[model samples]
Target: MIFVSLYLFMFCKMEENSGHISVADFSKHLFWDVNKSEIDLMRDRHYVVRRVFSCGLMNDWNLICRLYGIQEIGEIAKQIRDLDPKSHAFIALIAKIPEEDFLCYTTKQSTPQHWNF
Candidate 1:
């Protein structure tokens, strides 16, 4: 009886730790937020963020897509639009613009070198 009780306790704890990662609409996961903050600190130090790509497990890619206005079905479309000839030309034009007008995604850190934030 004692052994059975101990096994059950350990099993429950494991499940709790791997609790269902339900994708909340807008509210970020409290635990994930904490982890991100730590990662940001490491990034400031230029330490672990360079060594590790992505640390914590992401809940669901689909949820992020929906929130970002790019649903799963439209993902390919979104990609195509980004790389469209017109968009490419626009980006080229913008690249020629002065630094003050140049607004683009920072490539200083690739996904492999991305911190949680």
Candidate 2:
């Protein structure tokens, strides 16, 4: 039990300190349409942040949170127009930011709600 705990601690520290995250670290389907090796985490922060929020699992979320933290992710989320509704709400609540701060939320408001009728 101690060994597993120690290993987990070390793994989390490595992820936190490492500035790079590869596509392969995520689920296979997350980047199916792109060359996994070519995607640079820092250069493609917008893309990675969007896909991770929209389609990534809990592990993926945790990884990004560790790498970028809730504040950075929330800032990235602000510019992502296609972020899912649930994901948007989750981030807003977690980041303690209002829904109006998110581009997705504001854009959504600009359009007529189909569900309203």
C-alpha lDDT score of every prediction, in listed order: 0.29, 0.74
Off by over 4 Å in 1: 1-30, 33-59, 71-117
Residue-level lDDT for 73 in candidate 2: 80
As a TM-score, model 1 comes out at: 0.19
TM-score of each: 0.19, 0.73
lDDT of 1 at 101: 28
- Per-model clash counts, in order, read 0, 0
User: TM-score for model 2?
Assistant: 0.73
Cα lDDT of model 1 by residue, 1-117, tens digit: 456434533443344324222333223432344444444321232222111112212233222222222222122222232132332233233223322221222222233423332
Candidate 2, residues 23-109, lDDT tens digits: the string is 677878788899888988778878888888767886787677677766788899989886678777777876668999888876765
lDDT score for candidate 2 against the true structure:
0.74
- Which parts of model 2 are misplaced by more than 4 Å? 1-15, 18-20, 109-117
